[model samples]
Target: KLDMRRTLSEAINIQVPYNFERVMYLLSGGQNQTEAMLKMEQTQVITLSKDLHAKLQDWVSTYRVEDSEMLGTVQNLWGCHKYLSDPHTAVGVNAAQKFLHGTQRPCGAVICLATAHACKFEDAIRKALGSKFWDGTVLNDPKLMPPTAGSLQKLPEISRGTFREGEDWTQRLREVIEGRYPEATLVTPHLGTLWFSNQAMAMLLGITTAVCFAAILSKFARRSKR
Candidate 1:
């Protein structure tokens, strides 16, 4: 049920789906013994049932978009809103626009999630916005090229290990981990505190909605009066 194409959407749109078994195989460092041991502990594959799958199909409507459309979306957003969006986010926005304009248009606001920073996908950005603009403006712009990008690029490799076909990868990984940290440390997880109370949040949401509604009503009233 997946389409595999050579597009800007590299992360999600894949040829073969990496299932739980494939993940375990990777985590085991390609060691058959380690993979078997991991499988013994957790072997259950969670797949949606027929009814649930049917219900999901009924609820969700997926739109297929071309690379050209995604690029156009990215360019348009940048030109109009001064917002430089990544290819994946562009895909979502393009899809959302298609859905809104299509025959079965939904009422609610479609929030296209901007998952990653534009700096992360430099090649894609360069393609969307011409190389001339990218080199001249985007390269010098602090907002586009953040300090963290340079910092990340300058980061040294903490640990390195090779997993050869005929070698014991588990032992190799063990050696690497031990070399990095001789003694294992137990760190307690910190829980995040909520900023807003339930009542306060409800009141804020109500106010925002009321303001939006009032604006819409005012716009319509003016149109009718005209």
Candidate 2:
């Protein structure tokens, strides 16, 4: 009983139950930030000094006040409720509840925008929201096609060459052959929908990438020739 209690307490120590600072920080940002928003989310929990309390409070009070449109955008985006969530989502919920009184109708849902993968805050989520709050699908990459028998058949046909020793790919092939392919090989494909646009800005980025890549490749070739 003592050991179990100690373990539970250790778990609870890392879990952020209700952090006013975090809630304040999330709500202080842009009014409406989408999943594609490139802003570096300040997630590191900060314990404010006594002197900074008034300053922080002032910041929160004025946060997005100058940008009412952004405030409305964020509020509208987060108006719904969905049970699946994370800390940032919890912070949003906390904000909406405190400010918006949560959803009004019985049919309303709580839509949560999970800011980070659940594993990063699993202990915290489990402690504060309970373990069942986590669904096994948090980190799943939906972009990847599930392995099919057709894929397996094509794999053998695509590579009939015998595995060579002393190479990582060869070793991986050996593992696959030996039926020992580790879960570490599980790859998550990227969904590259996050993009910043504005035709002029995009053209600049394209030109920049081209110039950089050209310079890099030129240097690589020169080094190889030497």
Clashing pairs in 1: none
Off by over 4 Å in 1: 1-3, 15-54, 107-109, 153-167, 174-226
> Which residue pairs collide in model 2, if any?
31-70, 31-71, 80-111, 81-109, 81-110, 81-111, 82-110, 82-111
The residue-level lDDT of candidate 2 at 25 comes to: 42
Write one digit per residue (lDDT tens) for candidate 2, span 14-131.
3234344345446545222221122222343344446456646644431111122323333343344323343444555444454454343222344546464334454544445444
Best-performing candidate as measured by lDDT = 1
Candidate 1 achieves a global lDDT of 0.64
List candidate 2 segments past 4 Å from native: 1-59, 62-83, 102-114, 128-226
lDDT of each: 0.64, 0.39
lDDT of 1 by residue, 30-136 (tens): 43333333344454324444754565465456788898999999999999999989889999999999988887664456788998877777778888898987778
Candidate 1, residue 224: Cα displacement in angstroms equals: 64
